[model samples]
Target chain A: EPEVTQTPSHQVTQMGQEVILRCVPISNHLYFYWYRQILGQKVEFLVSFYNNEISEKSEIFDDQFSVERPDGSNFTLKIRSTKLEDSAMYFCASSRVQSENEKLFFGSGTQLSVL
Target chain B: LAKTTQPISMDSYEGQEVNITCSHNNIATNDYITWYQQFPSQGPRFIIQGYKTKVTNEVASLFIPADRKSSTLSLPRVSLSDTAVYYCLVGDPMNTGFQKLVFGTGTRLLVSP
Candidate 1:
């Protein structure tokens, strides 16, 4: 089964530094998304990308965050200035279709540790 | 997006059947109910989904009652390895352009010997 793949399984960064997490969605997937799960918290939506543009974003996706489909296969999330609260598990997901019952393929996730 | 409510945790013995129910009282007609299971340090995996009635798969079964206000995930003859967090999400499929899946604090299932 094809899957979404994320890089840098774990990352450690100091506060105020920029960090980027990368993902390679399934080759045939048309919609991509980024979500974060804070330790002991629920997974929250960050942003959704389609057609090389941001289709939607959550309030948690503020000025500090941005997403890009740098290439046909690579999607990235960049945080300009990280804070201690930014520590969490960032997940990348993709869905082949936009159907109500469609299931998302998720990566193992990139654990971002902002110190 | 509809809000979902589930129990914080559940405990079951090995070899027993377990049922976890999620309530989405304000579900829309176009919304579908889907469940995902997550182990520690990993991403959520699709378990089962149902629009209405009962849908069964190899891993689990999804039961959506009439009214569409709630759904149940049934795990039969579970084992210790089946311990994980289960999340229920409700969203419309037509809004595919930016369909965001909002996850609530999932129900943590602890299966022990």
Candidate 2:
């Protein structure tokens, strides 16, 4: 089965540095999303994207964060300045259609570690 | 999004059937109850989804009550490989053209031989 693939499975960066996480969602999927989970915590939604624009975002997605679909296949999340609290497993997901019944395919996840 | 509550952990032996129940008293009319499973260091994987009554796929079965306040995930003949964390989520899935899945602390199932 096709899957969402994320690059740099592990990322380590300085606290004040910028970081960009990349994802290649399923080729035919139209809706994309970003979620994060702190160690031993519940997974939290960050942002959702569709039609080349952000559909919704959580409070955690503040001024330091942004998402871009630079091309047909790549979805990227950028943090202008990283913080210790930003460290977590970031997941990328996609669905063919955004519906109550649609199933989402998730990437293994990018483990972001801030020093 | 409706908040869900489930047991923190469960233990079962191999070949036994396992049932994990989740409570969501605030489920909305458009919300669908879905379950996902996760192994250590991996993203959540879809298990089953249902709006009402029962829905079964090859991997698991989902049973939703008429009130839509609670749902159960049933795994038949579970094995050691079935040990993982299972999450129950309730949401419109497409409330604003995208599905924002909110995962609560999931139920951890440990299958022993």
Candidate 3:
């Protein structure tokens, strides 16, 4: 079973610093997404990417956040200025197609810790 | 996306069957009920999906009634390793261009030996 892989299983950064999280989606997948979960909170959607551009984003994804498909297989999420509240588990996911019944393959997740 | 309501937590013993139910009273015509399971410190994994009636897979079974207003996820003869949080999501995949899966507070199941 092919899966999505995320780098830097854990990251600790100071406030106001810039951080970039990288992910390699399944080779055949075309839709990629980023989601985050604060400790003891529900998972929240951040953004979705397709065709080398952002397809949609949630309110949680503000100016401080950006996503890119930097290469054929790599997808990245960059935070320009991290805040303490930015500490959470960031997950990368991908789906073979944009279908109602399609299931997403998720990475183990990158734990981002902002001090 | 239809809002889903489910139990916050459940406790079961090893080798027992566990059924987690989710209520989605406002489910739309095109909405599908999908279930995901998440262990602590990991991303959610797809368990099963169903439109109506019963859908069975290797891991679990999804039962949706004729009304389609609610669904049940049944895990047969669970073991300690089956402990995890179960999420129920309702959405119309075709209409959702971004395919964003809205997750509610999932049901945490603890299977003890």
Which candidate should be chosen as best, given TM-score against the real structure?
Answer: 3
Off by over 4 Å in 2: none
Clashes of 1: 0
Which lDDT tens digits does candidate 2 get at residues B1-113?
A: 78899999999999999999999999989888899999988999999999999999999999988898899999999999999999998888667347778788999999999
lDDT for each residue of candidate 3 in B8-42, tens digit (9 for 90 to 100): 99999999999999999999999999999999999
DockQ of each: 0.78, 0.78, 0.87
Rank by DockQ, highest first: 3, 2, 1
Interface RMSD of each: 1.4, 1.4, 0.9
The number of the candidate with the highest lDDT is 3
TM-score of 1: 0.95
TM-scores for all predictions: 0.95, 0.96, 0.99
Candidate 2 total steric clashes: 0
Report the Cα lDDT for residue A54, model 3: 92
CAPRI verdict (incorrect, acceptable, medium, high) for model 1: medium
Q: Cα RMSD to native, each candidate?
A: 1.4, 1.3, 0.7
